[model samples]
Structures are given as structure tokens and as C-alpha cells.
Target: EAAIGIDDSFYRVGGDSISAIRLLVLCREAGFELRISDLNNTSTIRSQAARALSDDVISAPGTTTQYAPFDSFDEETVQRLKDNVVPGIGLSWDSISDVAPATPLQRGLISETLRSDGGDAYVTWKITSFGSDMDAERLRRSLVQLVGSRSIMRTRFALDPILGVVQVVLKEQVGEELVPAVEYCTSASEVKARATAVSQDQRWGRPQTSPLHIQIISAQGEATSMVWFSHHALHDGWSFSVMEQEWRQLYDADGEKPISTIGVDVPFTNVSRYLAGRDNEDDLNFWKTYLADAEPVRLASGSTSGPPPPDANAQKTITHTTKCDLSSVARACAVPPSTVFLFALATALGLFADSDDISFGLILSGRTLPVDDIARVIGPCINTAICRVRLQQTQSAATALQQLQADLDEINERG
Candidate 1:
């Protein structure tokens, strides 16, 4: 939708910092890589669209004639492989042992696990390009290589009984069960439905074990479809897309491991450790003061003019979209498009609540500081900040937007 106009600026059309990151991910999924800054510099639609198209052409997946099959591992072999351990990849108990505390995010997941029912939070990717030469065994090997190479892919959470802490441990290698691939000769729709069902079924599996799976589907009597599923805790949208591209590269590599230039100076584990040590007093105070008296605009209350519906929970939402000149609005208001949208949302909420003050949580990309190769790190990298907007009944739109921008700027600075 943001690529329609050749002269349009991404920021001017409501693209914020997070949006820039998402655009880069989209480019990566389209078989290309683009820096967030590149999108910022080349804000015009023509430039970005052209670069994306060209990159897709250059990075197109190549056809393969020979590969491994799906039934490469037997029960005994897979069990032995999982029993093996890496020397220095997990918790240590030496005199100089450095204890790695769980980050707040991981702790949150731990709390969820204590609950009776945890949600299925995972991502799935369906692949259609499959040649007859590409067998399950070959795909299994590529997946094994992928898991061994990426730290996040190999990570698992283990509770340290002595320390009373759940520390992340990297397995030496994943077993066949972890990376199982089976042939399913079915239609595309059936394959997708089955894959989704399987992915959701394993959402609550132990994190100490590999939370990834691959299902091979042969559509139209040809073995040409595959589905990849992984737990969301292992990575975000960006990291997942990168992993997808890397898997493709490994599959295409002719009996050789692809050279990995996507170096990570600061791994996800460091970020977790840093967050554990970093002080959040100021952020806490900001949120406390910000939301002290702010009330959420409740859309449902005792204001019904007709009979109650058959099932209140069976509600459906309809979205209407139209192309508006957002660039013009940005220029007129002297604020970014994101701010414009935020102000509009706040205004709508104010009307809904019959008040002019509102507060809500705005999720932000967690990488505020410049961590080397942070973008490439595969893990949960999102944080939520308090967004409080107070507008007068007679306040102009531009004025309200400016005030909102100021509030966000202060929060960013504090964070």
C-alpha cells in the first residue's frame, strides 16, 4: 500500500521507525535485503519499488537436481544426537561461573508457563517452489545445519535448581524429531490447513527442546511444497524472514555450507543480560505518572438501544480503507504521519469516552540503543511505552499532534 506513489515519502505517508523496520523485512521476504536507513534516504516510492524488484531478480531461488530425503534419521540415532552436549554452551558451576539471568521477556514467558493453558504463539511459512530432486532428507540436512549455525535456533530454557533461575542453554544439535519432515501428497489448501493445525498443536512444547518443525507437502502429485513453523519466542518477524532466506541459501548450496557474512557482534543472549542489569526506575516513574488518572475509553457499556444479540462474543469487525493524501496532511500539520494517526486515534477515543484525555500502551521496537548487528539478532525485540494524550475540546488538530509528539519524544529520551 505504501508503494503506490512514485513521489511519496514513506514517513510522510505514515511510516515511522517501526514501519521502516517492517519495510526492510518485506524486502527481505521478497528475496532482497534493504537497510532501514536506505528506505529513509530513498523515501520515494519509485526508488524503493525499483530496488525491491531488482533485488528479487538477483536473489531468485535456484533449481536443484539432487538433495536428501525426509526419513534420514531413525529413532535410536535421533535420541543419541539429542543426548550429546556442547561443552561451553550452557549453565556452568565453576568458581568463576557467570550466571545469566532471565530477561524480563523470558520471565514473562515463564509466568505464562506456570498457567494451566498457554497460548500458541508461533510463525508459519509455506513454501511452493519444490523440484522433484529436492527430497525430505536434503531438506532435513539444511534444517539441521540451520539450527546448529544460529544461536537462537539452537536455544532452549533450562531451570537451574541450585540457582533457582531458568537459564537459556544451546543444544549441541537438534534431533530428527525436532526437525521432522514428512511427505503429504495433498492439495495446497489441505496442506496449509494441516500445517497450521500442527504448528498450533506444538505451541506449548518445552522451550528447552527445539520449538521448530518442517512439513513437506506434495501437491498435484508432485513433491513441491513445504511448510516451516517456529515458536515466536525464538525470533521476531525480521529474524524469521532472515532465517527463511538462509534456509533457502543452504538448500541451494551445492554440497557446501554457505558463507555467513551476517555477523552478530551482540547476540540475543547479551541483550537479555543487558536488560536484566539495566535500571528502569525512570521509565517506571514516567509510566506511573503518565497513567495515574487516565481511564481507558470503554466502547461497550450499558448503552444499547436494541435487544441483546444471540452471542455477544461472536462480534465481527469491518475495516474500510481509502487512499487519502497523508503527505499533504503531514505537511499542513508540521508533524510526521505516525503522529497524525496517533492524534486521530486519540481524538476518536476522546469522542467515544466523552472526554479529552486518554492513555494507552504503544509498542515500540526494543532496539533504542545502537547495538551492533542488532537487527540481525533473532529474538523478541519489542517494548511497550506509555502513550498519554490530553487534548482540549477546542484544541486544533495540529496543536494536539504537536503535543503528542512532544510526549513521545520525552518517553524516547527517558527510555
Candidate 2:
């Protein structure tokens, strides 16, 4: 008889609903009566195997059920959904400030991007009730209403073809309900303060490309919430924080009028326009000169896992985060914080690549320029800059920082 434990290899180990039904059918064919519910109750493969053995039945190896691979929506279907559905936008903030509402053109651009991208967003939370009296439905409703009122919380859908403008709509549901709240003895004030802090921390450094995720959980009868903003392609950290404050205010007010409307208008279109006008020759030269004799380094073992095989719709993504202390950063070539950050990031990538010929992408904020002002509205305003680093045997961290600082200074000056 097979042992039963968490590590046991069961046919339904990671099976979804459909696979569960098929497993039941196969068990019946093997002269062991089983139901889908039985599999749910006995989640482990070992447990099921033990049950089968006790039933005095031997099952064929090939008869074990396998989960069907997930199918992704095709580009055409995704495009259609983009044309029809509005997507959620996550923003961030450095500090709270007020600005004008999104212009019609700005809104349109955001809508178009989301549609093409298929705007599926999520937020998770843990809820705790302070008093013995707690209403799950009421709390849920409050959260819904809070997100519904904000312009940022409203999903943005595209309206125009050429301009790709977006229109806003409130989301109907916030996704699945997780576990119920755990009871504890925490003051509401302490809980709220902690939630606010979490909200701030959850803001993304790069807020345009990734989707926003909010996580909430209850601790000691206090509710804690963590809000995640999408990548730099859609919004920024500053804008996301503004949205969080609004959500919290609305939640605490029990759906009262918002405290105030303050936002920033950063010129994303202008940045795109500026980058488009730049001479490709200079950028190309920068890459060539920096990486001419360098060989491409393979950072991760699977870094060269070339594009997925033909007709393989499965998608894969790799995320890496590296940090350097302030002292090390300051000491590196005596560069500023920004330069240190860029240099360290480049160095990390170079180390990961383990080769000298690798090219990596970095995101830069367009709001760095003075003319751009659209700060309150959520949209993609970051530009991608590719750098080719030459990892020579004799290159030191300070040398790399000096080289990067020079390259960055050139880019900024030219811009």
C-alpha cells in the first residue's frame, strides 16, 4: 500500500474541477467506487492510494487522471475583450498633492493600452472585527463602495481608435473571497494606522506595466490592508498612493464625500515624442562602444530558454530584486543616489549574466522633466532605456559606476 502524506504523488495532486470528475470515473472503472467529494476530502495522493488498497483493488498505472493544460485566450479574443472591458488602474505617491483631472486625450490613451493588455487586477485582504459584533457582508460592501467612488478605482476602457482614449467604470466585484477574519484584541486606531502604513509600502516603484494587487488580513480584531500598484507601464508610485488614501478615506467615512482632489500631470506623451526625435545613431553608438568586445553573459541558468516552442501558448516571467546599502551606493564612484541605483542595478545584471555581451532594459520616469504635469491620473508614462554593459575581468564596481554615470549624464544632457 502507498503511504499517505503531503508529498505523495497523486493523480489529482494539482487537478482542477474537471480533472477531479475524470479521476472519479477512472477509479470506478478500476472496481473502486469513488466520488469527487471523496477526493476533495482526501486531497493527498497517498490518502487516496491507501483508500484504494483498503478496498482490495489494484488500479492500472495509466488509468490515473491527468489535469488538462490551461488554455489561454487568443489574441483576437483578448483584443475583443480589450475593446469591450475597462481595466483597473493602480497608482502611487511620494506625497499627497492636488492636480487637474485627466484630459480627454489622456484618458483615451490609458483605455487603449489596458484593452490591448487585458486589464485583470486583484487586491487581497485580511479582516478583523474589533467588537463582538461583525458583519462580513457590511465590511465587504464598504470596501466595494470605497473602490467604486474613486476615478482611479473605476476601470478604464478604450473609446477611440486613433487616439486610444479610455473611459472609466466602477468594478462590480473585487474577485474571490479568501479566508474569514480571525478574532483578536487590537484597538481600531492601531489597526487603521498599520493599514495606512501597509498601503504606503505597497505602492510600486515602477507603476505602469504591472497590475495592482491589494492584500488584506485581520490581526487581533484589527483589519490590515496592503495595496499593490501595477508596473511602470500603467501608473507610478505617487499616483497609486493617492488612490490608496482615497480608498481608505472613503472606507472610513462610510461613503462620505472625499476629503479633496489633488493630482499631478506628468507629460508622458512629450517624453515619447522626445525619445522618438532622438538620433538613433547616438544610442546605437552608446551600446556598441560600451559592449563592443564584451561577450553576452547568461545570468540565470534558464536565461537562454529561447522563446517558447511554436504553438506553446504558455507564458513565463522572471522577476529579480537586488539591493545595495546606502553606504556602498555612496562610495561607488561618488555618484548621486540615482546614479548609484542605476549602476548597482547594472552590476547586478552583469553578475547574473556572467557574460560581457548582455543587454538589459531599465525604466526611467518621464516626470523627471519639468514640462510634464499629469500626476493624479493613472497611466503609462515611463520609458525603457537599454544598456549594454561590458563585464571585463579587470572592471571594478567603482569603474562600472563611473562608466554608467558618464553614460547617464550624456543621456540626460542630450535630452
Instruction: Write down the lDDT of every candidate, Cα atoms only.
Output: 0.57, 0.42
RMSD of 1: 11.8
Q: After TM-score superposition, what is the CA distance of residue 168 in candidate 1 from its true location, in Å? A: 1.9
Residue-level lDDT of model 1, residues 1-415, one tens digit each, is 5354778766556656666655655555454545544534235778766876666434532221111211223455333323432122232322111224556666566456545354343333445456556665667666667665666665555554332334443443543445665656566566556655554555434454445556665554444556665655666666767777777677777367544533332346655655655678987887788778887766665333567787877867879887867657765654567777888887777776666677767866665433334556677776657688898868777677666766775665454
Point out where model 1 deviates above 4 Å: 1-15, 19-99, 118-138, 160-165, 175-177, 181-204, 215-221, 224-227, 259-266, 302-323, 331-334, 412-415
In Å, residue 383's CA in model 1 sits off its true spot by: 2.1
Error of 2 at 77 (Å): 26
* Candidate 1 TM-score over all chains jointly: 0.64
Q: What's the true lDDT of residue 291 in model 2?
A: 57
